[model samples]
Target: MKLLDSGFRRNDNKLFFLTFYDIASPKTGGNMAGKKKGRKISGKKAGLSPGSLVYVGSRTDEPVRISIMDYDADRIDEIPEATLDDIKKCMARDSVTWVNVSGIHDTAIVEAVGRLYHLHPLALEDIVNTRHRAKLDDYENHLFLVLKMVIQEPETIRIVFEHVCLVIGPDYLISFQEREGDVFGPVRERLRKTKGRIRKSGPDYLGYALMDMIVDHYYEVLDQLGEEIEAIQEEALSNPTAKMRRAIHDARRQVVVLRKTIWPLREIVAGLLRGESKLFQDGTMIFLQDVYDHVVQVIDTVETYRDLLTGAMETYMSSVSNKMNETMKVLTIMATLFIPLTFLAGVYGMNFKYMPELEWRYAYPSFWGIVLVVFLAMLLWFKNKNWL
Candidate 1:
């Protein structure tokens, strides 16, 4: 595996390089390439040293890799795998260049890129450690951005999170990704076809395009979530069982998590729009404004889903109450039907010496007739009351 270096002359006439690597090579030594050389410490001594480097991005057994795409309005070049020195030579030219860095787990390669680009240590740290919230940082010479890219796994609704770090300078844009695959295929196609304003624009426009792609994923996710919410609503209305209630609750929690994920994203995009960084040009700001609108739409959709889930919960409760009331009505009707019969049985069961009905043979039949009349009358009364 080779590192790409795009050499650009700084104001001091010093050469700065851009490095690219092909991570699939076994000769690259993978994670062991930059193993720290130091004595192992334990307990208090371990605490004395800086904490162990945490690898928060992609994990791959293959070597690190990089690719460079240098272009302008009339010229374009694609270097599949360029060495660091080769990239440096290209960067010295007047054309706009895009360096794509894939596989950031190797500390040596990451540090080398930082040094070449004169990136701040904290910025390099943020790039190497990927568990960062989405943000935009403006340095004097360039802008650094950290964003999460989400992709839906085929045949499944699950989302995979990938961190993409961007460095936007005057004439170049650097994209750092944890893994190899990306959604920028369309952008590359546009660049190749000279379609739209991409080729005519600068690095800022490129950055906008990439961000727009990322925001589009949010729409896809929101659509799926909306469909799920609708389905849950329908199920709740049709069959209000314990299982349905649990499902509604689970759906509500998922919506809450979705809201949490998307809420801050709006702010991040909004900050980019308002930021004074030269990395975003006037034309690009217009594009970012559109992106901000999309973000707002996403946030609105999430809130709507939350409200629907809440309404479903209420519907479930009402259904349960109605069920309980119906059960009580049936029980009351049964009690009413047995009342007169119970009284008649109690009267006949008594052994009173002066009881006229117990003395004669005809009395037994007549007593049953009287009990039948009482039961019929009570049934009619219940029917009139609409309790049966």
Candidate 2:
């Protein structure tokens, strides 16, 4: 991993190390940054000047990987790991140049790329922060886009998001990701096989394809959440437990996060469709419209899921309350039935010497008969009142 010597003094390096150490520390609930379970706080840059290139995210040991894909209608050149010279060569050509940087922990790569492409310092800063939500910033020569690549953990409804930034220029598109994996495999495949209009399109179209894939993956996440809701619903009705209640809450949280991440995307795509930025071409507007529609659908689905989970949570609470009420009713009825029996026993146990009951042998039996009659009358009354 190449380090940015100029960007980090010795003290700055220590500060960076201490910040990441805090992120990796095992302390629990020291002071929650937010409600997120394992999110890294962006407070590392709190006191820093604007456009400082501090990596405020999960750290990694893997070396930075830069891949290049330069293509046009005739042919394509693919570089698995591109050097600076290779990037420059690709950028000089008339073909569409795509430079994909897989890791951003090393500020050198970001700095070098920024110098090469004349990217704004603020844009580069946001690229490494990893906590910014989806947004768009149009510069004089390029359009900067921040998007989240979301994935649900296996066999669980937990959603993980990776920050991605795309800089779309006239002939080149530079992408920066927090990690190496992405949903751009299909787009890569299309470019390789010359399958469609992608090879003939500009970098904006490529950006659209990448964004579209991310949006499409939201459908899969929604499907998983939908299944989780159904299971929670069934369990809630049958037997609501504390664990099940927690599951409902967790699912609701996931939906909320998904909604917040995806909601702003609609506005971003709509802005592109409205020709707010000249980076997007007229030909790309239709495709951006499609993406906008998909965003709308995803937002609608998220809303529906949010409402469903809320309803599920309500149903779980209601079921629990009903069970409690039922138990209390049964206990109340039993207590009511014992009230008269206790009263008669108390009345007969008095130690008065001239008590009339002590003079008769049948006093005890008469008392027992009176108790049975009272109990039976109360029981009958309860049955008639439908309170049994």
Candidate 3:
């Protein structure tokens, strides 16, 4: 869960360095373990609720770490720890510098970075508050972007969501992740190896590369969901148990959650592409368009899965109805066969000695024969009617 960043300039130099430590590091004090216990607080004290600091990203209390990558086409320099002096040095250099910070639990460090870059207080607030939705705000000097990075657990089919904030400045890019694990490994490797146009592009392209990685993960999650939906469909058809019903319901719930996460993302990316922002360049619009397309694909896939799950629910209901009707049909036919036979038994069990059927032994045999014949006749009728 270490953090790293690679910076590339138009001139082709690349610098790479690790930025932060994982939350489990000793410095974090294991604050991410569970919910903080407390008594109910009212009025001003409520503002200090432990949950006030929304744990929108990771539950880690890791110390904030920073790294700087300064590079130009000819030469590159990597600084493992990017202090205020390092930022000033990189700003004075004739290269593209990328400062990456990991761990947002420390508000002071966040404010310091904001102050160094002359970032707006609102943007700084958004940075410190990890629960903010995915968004892109354009300031004259830079673009502030908030995005959620999701990872699917292989064993549980559960998703863990994290927030990654980006500040695209004039000559530099600053990325902040709530946790240490980042999906930007490919982008890092590409920058390090000088693969493709990454080194040749500007800072906006770097922002696109990072955004593109986040969107790519949306596809992976949808793919996993598609598999799960297919399994639920099969289970609903073959053996519609109560467990299967619950599975369908849970699948639908997940679809709802996925929709909530993805639908707004479409708008956010679309806003970035449509609006005029200093962070986005004309050449970078095409990349943003690609990301936008990916968002649309993810949305469509989510919707399709939702529709399929709904159909499965209907099918399950129909199956249950058919089973109930079959059970009732058997009970009805048994009742129909016994009605006349029960009447005959009642007549014979009567205590009246004057009844002619009770006078002789032959009469008793005759009454039994009549009862048997009636029972057989009712069976034949039921069979003919296909009620058997």
Which has the greatest lDDT?
Answer: 2
lDDT values, one for every candidate:
0.69, 0.77, 0.70
Candidate 1 has its poorest 10 consecutive residues by lDDT at 23-32
Better of 1 and 2 by TM-score: 2
lDDT of 2 by residue, 37-65 (tens): 23353567778899999997775666788
What's the TM for model 1? Answer: 0.78
List, residue by residue over 198-250, the lDDT tens digit for candidate 3. 77677888888988888897788677667667776776777777877777776
lDDT of 1 by residue, 1-388 (tens): 2221111111232222211121221111121122111121223223433323445543455466788888888888988786677678777989888888877778678777767778777677678665567777787788888887755443333444566889988988888877666667778878888845898789989998898888887787667666666766776676688867766766666666556656667777778788677667787888889988988888888788889989988988888898889899889877877887898889888887787768788987888898788889988988898877
TM-score of each: 0.78, 0.84, 0.80
Which residue pairs in candidate 3 collide?
11-73, 12-73
Candidate 2: C-alpha RMSD to true structure equals 10.0
Ranking by TM-score: 2, 3, 1
